[model samples]
Target: MVKKQDQVTHNAKPTAVESRGGKSTIAIKGTFPEKYFAKKATMTITPAIKNYNGEIKQLTPIDFQGEKADGKGQIINYKEGSGFNSVQNIPYDPAFGKSILVLNSTVKKGEKEIKLNEKEIGEVNMSTKRQDIDPKLVYKNQTSDGTNYYFSEHNYIPNNLVVKTATIFFDFNSDKLNWNLPFNQKEENKQALSELFPFLMDYDSIQSIDIEGWASPEGELRRNQQLSNNRSLVGKKWFEKELESYLKKQSKETKSFMKRLTYKLYDKGEDWDGFINALKNANIEDKDKIINVIQSQATKIQKEQQIQNMIAIYDEIDQKILPCLRRSYFKISCVENLRTDEEIMRLVNISPDSLTKNELLYAASLTNDMEMKKKIFSKAIELHPEDYRGYNDLACIKVAEGKTDEAKKLFENANVLKSNNDVVLNNLGIMSYQDKDYGKSEKYFNESQKAGMDQSKNLALVKDTIYTIDYQTKPDIEETANDDKTKKQKSEDD
Candidate 1:
């Protein structure tokens, strides 16, 4: 009996398709009817790419043949195995929208050859959807160094001078500034007083003078309170006398030019806080017990009694700690010589090295022109190579100019200078995402967030890209099932 054409069937489907580095490999599994064996049977599979422009390109084909049966009229069954398979690698282009895997099978019996089946096994999306560059990521503003001082409507340029502080030790239980005492006779004390004289005489106006008087915690609370107040008053009087003497020595024009100075006095009675702070650094025994007693004591009298009972510790405290507590702490705040904007602009162009790192950074912020900003940042990095802000800001300029590779290198250098910098990490993530490395980009974005970067927008972009790539690579179960049903019906009709 002759078998009907409808009794023989062929099936072809792609097992998997893997894509990377602008290339893809498609693996196909083909099946022939168990009872349909011929002397010579051949299967050919071809891969093709359809680009967005509707252009189609054919790739190399894969061919496989079945072995002939032993004798004429001998029925050999084709077993289910990997013998009917085809593997082809095709060049993947980002511009291409889809990759098509085509399958064809033919059978040769006696002197006649007949086609069996021809179908498309599967198709995968080759196009990649890239997200738009985030504006925030492309134009990161440089961070401030927090050294710029603002006064009134003008920016105060630091003269490289720090706030000056002076301490004056007093005699035991005494509040007066004992000028004749040996402690006060030290050269440091003389220099401190002399420095105060010139500061008042030279500056047109002093910002403020804070006099904080502290007394040892061993005495009665009320006595200690009065003693601290008296010490602050006496310290203020000494400064007043010194200023008067200095002004008397100054010319009349100098006195006329000086502005009225402001002063504040604070009586910090019983320097208990300072005492505890000192004990933390002290190497004396029973330090923990002392600290515990001090913290646990509810009243000043209780604390004083507890400390007095520790007589063995008192000698050390008296010699090492108490002397330092019986003193007045004073700080003088003064206005620094400031530069005008005109002068800063001129100096930035002429002598950028003269400006502080903060000044150079601030100068960059002052201008809207990209070229000027770049020049200012160049000078800033030249002068302060150790500071990562200069490199970070320069990288932002590179990004805005579409020099992404250069920006990436700059960000890497910045990260080397300041490891785990939020801005540098975020920019690196952006570069990775643009390169279609979604996993690497996600890793970088997460790290940037851990480093304190505000990466919500960039993270969302990465997630969207990942979803797009995943959907493109893996077929949906429902869609694949429907496709199988359609192919089966078509095969049966044929």
Candidate 2:
């Protein structure tokens, strides 16, 4: 009976060992059981791959013979057994993604021979090629040892700036909606409002709509003060009515989530500052004097009085400037889960520019396709170059794909865009851990834990994970499975 091979290689634990220069190898080394071979028997051993498709491909075979056997090959001492080492690599093949390494052997003496059952040695899985890199990232930076290692976990969710804003003006002292007002009719305002309704319809995504009403400083103090308050109410009422009407036309399913729309109103009374700003920019008569008069006035009444004086005196300030100051500004900020994954994916592909940096990052999570995520992150980097997420994220992809050189560049770029960012720093730390650079790994992990993005790197990560044999072990642990090392250890002992 053949003794089970002692697997010393940790390559069995998966970190996605990428093939280099078109070469892929599976090596085997183990001790033959003491006296397992017959005194005059000779044996031949061959290793093979039983692939996912149920096909077997045989590799080169090596021969061993007992001391008394008529063979001129590696001799097996029948009393002590023996340790053998063999490494066989082939050109990389995608079909080898999910396969089994098995041993095939024949024991022969004289004209009689016996073929043994193929025994599974280990599994070969290349599925990690689809890894998002950081979902398992390779820290791109290199230490004193070498530039190889991977680190990443799918823990962080990017925070997005979901709020969008627009301003629509009202006539001074009026609380009514002004359809024809130029500020209300501005194309940009229309564009802003255009997106507002869809969010309101999906009301769940809409966090809140805040409308702030303002009045230019003029007329009776109390009246002008109350004007903004009334304007806010008027705008609120209009949205309530508009949304109600819109919901009335929706199906019950669509209407179910539209039960209520949250509206917060604010009265930012007396745009005296706005009036002053208008005064400075105005080329009308007594611009400087008007500014002086308004600034000199201590009380709101006096300021209102000066504004009235100016209104009565300068039609340019009264008709043109005051109208701009008296307006309602509204903002609709969305919640974190604003868009559906499908919508985000569509936007990522069709109009990535339309997405915020956070949306782009989150969109990468919408699909399992690595290339799609790379596309999304690339767009984020292009549109929001100042942001670190894009660089850190794309670099992670690079690392997972065994493109450490590219990963290094991107992570370095991320470090530059935002120094000591927890997510990026922690990734660097994990890379260090992978490379057994414990000190550097801890420093980075601690910096990340105490730094931003609310991440905490576990210093005991490798030790803790190394115990699992999780379809794999830590890279350090995985090294134990190396055939060459196992073979060398025996050779050294002998």
Candidate 3:
């Protein structure tokens, strides 16, 4: 086949054909105009095959001579037959079913070179047919959730107060707190007092203190009231003296801390409530009868008289309950400070163990780098295996990495730790959707929505996927009808 200028034409028969191998040699002929070959030029002809997929396979490159100036100052003309006539062997290739010949020519004079127009000079159509290939879905990385879980700092106190109460008893009819009381002489009382002394000295360490004083019920109503009030005053005075002594021994910084301290005093007169509580819990005989008498009596004096009349159980009451009534109760609450964000971040790298589980999880959320997030989350899970946030966040990293199975397992583990975690459930739903488990995906999405997760976008995506699947699988009735009508018309025409 030969393509003339601005037109393509084919000869009736091949120039030469090999009988044994069936390889055909086709002659390609073309001529350049005089001005085109005036300069000393070089020409190259390349034969190639173009496949159905738009890829080209080269056959062979042919070089041609150019016009050159002779020693006699005359031009040695490059004739058409010598420079443009060439034959190319076309081989059988399933992919290269269509072939073409391209011509490229360059002109050179001394150091200057110029490229001529490259042209498609010839074409051939082979007998082979092109094969069909199936298309596939290309996998793409998904965007991150951009949601972060931070550790709550405000109103969050880490240290819990170890509650210790010290009770000092008073003798019957006495309003003063005896320093030499038997209860005060006990080792536990000394330990309790020791635990409370430091908090009293450092105002920053203590939140508050409550002092309550009580008197036994077997007394005059007015006398008992006066006794409870004086006992509360005496108890408060003793603590104030102890605090003053503590401040005297401390430096100015600690002495000044007393300014922030707060104190509350309560006078529990007659201790009737304490008496009823003691009676309810006591292991003595006629307990129900004593409780009934106390409940039935309308007046405080009548109750006292009824209690004093229980001569058999009076010893039990004096030894077991009355001493508890004639006493002072001191309750001290201490302040707990939380670590700052900067301090927690600094320690996370150097000493991660120093940070709480929430702090470690929060550190992961503070950075956008995936590798750093993975490291922090790994450390969080290692430190606190029971917390679900660590597992859920780490699973997000796995999902971004295209490890869907690993992400599913991590999400399941997170779910086991904290059942129905919104983030975990949402991620699992996404995984199921990606795997084409539509029913399972819908189930997870519904559950996630119930768990307070925003699944509107995810649900929309699932609906779209279902529609696409249905559309692709459904039959085309119009196309089938048209095909049948065309077949019948062709039969009638035949």
Best by TM-score: 1
Q: What are the lDDT figures for the candidates, one per model?
A: 0.65, 0.67, 0.63
In model 2, the runs with Cα more than 4 Å from the true position are 1-161, 202-205, 248-258, 280-289, 338-494
Give the alpha carbon lDDT tens digit for every residue of 28-120 in model 3: 555454334434544444555565577776766655444563222223254432224556566655455554445554444556656655555
How well does candidate 3 score on lDDT at residue 214?
A: 85
Per residue, candidate 2 scores C-alpha lDDT tens digits across 1-494 of: 43433321212232225543454555567577675767787878787767778987778887888888898668978778878777776444567656676777787888998787656667654432211123333332323222233322333343334777767678767888887987778788778765666565543456778998888877776786688898888877776666666656664444555455578899988887787787788888778987888889888788878777777878998778888878777788776555666777788778888876666776776667879878877887889888777888888777768786787788878888888676777777666665566678678778876875333325544323211111322343346668678899999999
Model 3: colliding residue pairs = none
Q: Worst ten-residue run, lDDT, model 1?
A: 145-154
TM per model?
0.51, 0.41, 0.42
Tens-place lDDT per residue, model 1, 1-494, is 02433443333333333333445455544444654444355434444555446567776665545456323322334453233445555564565545444444344545656664445445556444545554542333344321111111113354534367777888778987677665577899778867876665555446788898889898889999998998888888887776777777774444443336667999999998888888878877878888898789898899988767764556867666776788887788776556666778899999998876777776776678889988987787788899887887888788779888887787778879988766667767767876778788888788878988677767777765311221132235448778999999999999
TM-score of 1: 0.51
Each candidate: RMSD: 12.8, 20.5, 25.6
CA error at residue 7 for candidate 1, angstroms: 15
Q: State candidate 2's TM-score.
A: 0.41
